[model samples]
Target: MTFGEKIFKYYQQINVPQDLPTGVEVLYPFDSTEVADLTRSFYMRYFNDKRPRTFLIGINPGRFGGGSTGIPFTDPKILEEKLQIPNTLDKRHELSSRFVYQMIDALGGPEKFYDSFYFTSVCPLGFVRDGKNLNYYDDKALEEALEEYMAGEMRKQLDFGGNEIAFSLGMGKNIKFLKEFNRRHNLFKEIRPLPHPRWIMQYRLKRLDEFIGVYRETLAPFMPDFHK
Candidate 1:
């Protein structure tokens, strides 16, 4: 089967919970042909034959971005209006997403990042409280929920075939998850950690360059062709 077909089938196989106390949202951007148009237009290009052997995994989907658009860290305004990326999921709010977009823009935007890297999550689904999203760590049932999620990730990774490095978006949970995976299978060349862009933006905007400097150092061997 083709790569896209593998991903599409994987999406169908996952046992996403339909209902929960507040709600369980699993946004599948690649489900329908219409939505997959955007998936093809934007995300598909990020994982072509020439794409880099790196994976950028987040803790989970945020409400407005992945939760709403079904694409990791994708902002609704940017996806719908700017990139003309279509979405079937309803609109919502996400704060860290904009900062992530900004950082990507600074790092030469999607065209550049996607050329070498693809983004995803430890958990593809979104968790909500009264209505507001509770971050991955905030969810009380995350430990059990995440084990199931990691199984799905391993499946996707196996489909992708060869990945040299796995970059966790934050120094917290994503790192913990990936490190454990590395130990279990020895499947990755290296798994690196960086502070979440949200934390960088909110707490150290002035030191953005420094934070990115550290990140670059970690990624140096893999990003040899990238411009400084």
Candidate 2:
């Protein structure tokens, strides 16, 4: 099967129970027919080949980003405009998505960058509490409850056969959790931590280009021909 086919199937198989903990809501964009179709279309268009890709793991989807578009780190505007993947979701721009695409552009554009890497969250699905985004590490009980599910999803992605080096988006809590998880599971050879795009965009906007440069430097070693 093609890479896109595998991803499409993976998303289809994601089944998070509705009766989550008290205040949590699983933001399943795939539930929306428009999002589901758009996701599949995006994958089919850009990920049609079977090239091995490195993994870049984010914490979870944001409401206006992956939660709406069904693509990791992608907001509606980026999906429609930058990716040229038409969608009917609200066209709200997300800071994280903007930084990600900017880094993508710096790394020789989407076609080359995506061809060598896959973007996904540690938890395949996202969660929210009282309309605010929640990370898996936000609640200890919730994290323990979903450990098996999250590990299963990670293993499933590994089955696709990519570079063993995984990039962790958030260097703080998210990477801390991932390190512990990987120690127990041995999921990846290395989990390199990077600043979350949202954090960089929010607090270090003045150093935007510097952050992009950091992304390029860190990712370059993984893709030898990246700058070419």
Candidate 3:
């Protein structure tokens, strides 16, 4: 099987629990093509295609984002309705799923981008807090447990990959994790930092053009041939 298919198949077997199902208390577990797509991107870049030159990383899966769509920063509603990908979920009330779907539209759709670049996260599981689905900061114990799993598995899959440039969304904890991953394992040649698209769309719509402008530049040197 191809690398992408292999990763997708493996995703089908993963069984993380959905502790938070509603309000802010739902920690939806990972599942489906959204997870399959992101994880497959990691392996396909280096193993199958060997042509992907860039990698973008997020902190972890949000209940509505990766947790539901399986694709990082993906919106559940659009992912199902527009992208024709079944969500298999409707959890996490405060997630940015809708916003993410809009972002994909603004960025020229999924087929345009997923053809080349890749998106992923430091931690793959969803997190929650005192009756609230917190962002990456809610479940320390869960984070630690998943960290080992992600790293160990990625090491096997991404081992000594080529000169792929890496980018991280948001800052603080996510950057710290990427730094540690780079230092410990040297996954990519270099890693750049970018503000999460959610942050830009949330408080800085006017600045979104500028943000996308920068993203265009970053993606310029690494655009992939969708025709292939």
Candidate 4:
């Protein structure tokens, strides 16, 4: 089966864990017909091949970006402008999504970059508390509650035919958490951590080009004919 088929099936089966902390709410865009359609379009267009792509797993979805557009790391603007997958979601930008698309452009556009790399998240889902975004690790209780579910879902993603090497999108807590998950599950040969796009955009805006170069360099070894 093509990667898209596998991913679409996975999406249809995932459900929000019922035991979330009292204030935490999960984002499930696939419940929306418009988002499901757009997401299916994006996946089928770029990931129709049966090839095994490398995985770049981030912390979790941001309600404004992937949660809204149903595509990991992609915001509405990038959805329509870069991938040309039109959507009715808000046009407000997301910092992580901006840096990601820019890095994708540097790495040779979406078609080529996405052809070789698949983006998802450690949680494969996102949370919000009091109407604001929340990371899975933000609350200790949430972290503990998701321990098993996260591992199982990650195993499912690995079964989607990714290469042995995986990239952890955030350099700090996310990488630390993913390492534990890997140690327990033996998920990948290596989980290389990158400065997350949100961190680069938020704290290191001046080094945008440098971070892009870092991403380009990390991918160079695995990518064929990559630009130096």
**What residue pairs are clashing in model 1?**
none
Tens-place lDDT per residue, model 2, 1-228, is 988899988898887854457989888878778887998888888789988789999998989999888899999999889988877778999999999999999998888888889999889889999999998889887888788888888898877767878999999999999999999988999899999999999999999999999999999787767757
Q: Which stretches of candidate 4 lie above 4 Å from their native place? A: 225-228
lDDT scores in order: 0.63, 0.89, 0.57, 0.89
> Per-residue lDDT for 40-126 in model 4, tens only?
898898889898889999989998898888789999988998788878889989999999999988888888898789999999888
Q: Write the per-residue lDDT of candidate 1 for residues 113-202, one digit (tens) a residue.
A: 555566667666666666676666665565455565566565565565447767888897768866876677565787788788777878
List the candidates' TM-scores in order: 0.76, 0.96, 0.70, 0.97
lDDT at residue 143 of model 3 (Cα atoms): 50
In model 1, state the lDDT of residue 208. Answer: 79
On residues 20-54, what C-alpha lDDT tens digit does candidate 3 reach at each position? 33444434444444556544554454336334334
* lDDT at residue 83 of model 1 (Cα atoms): 62
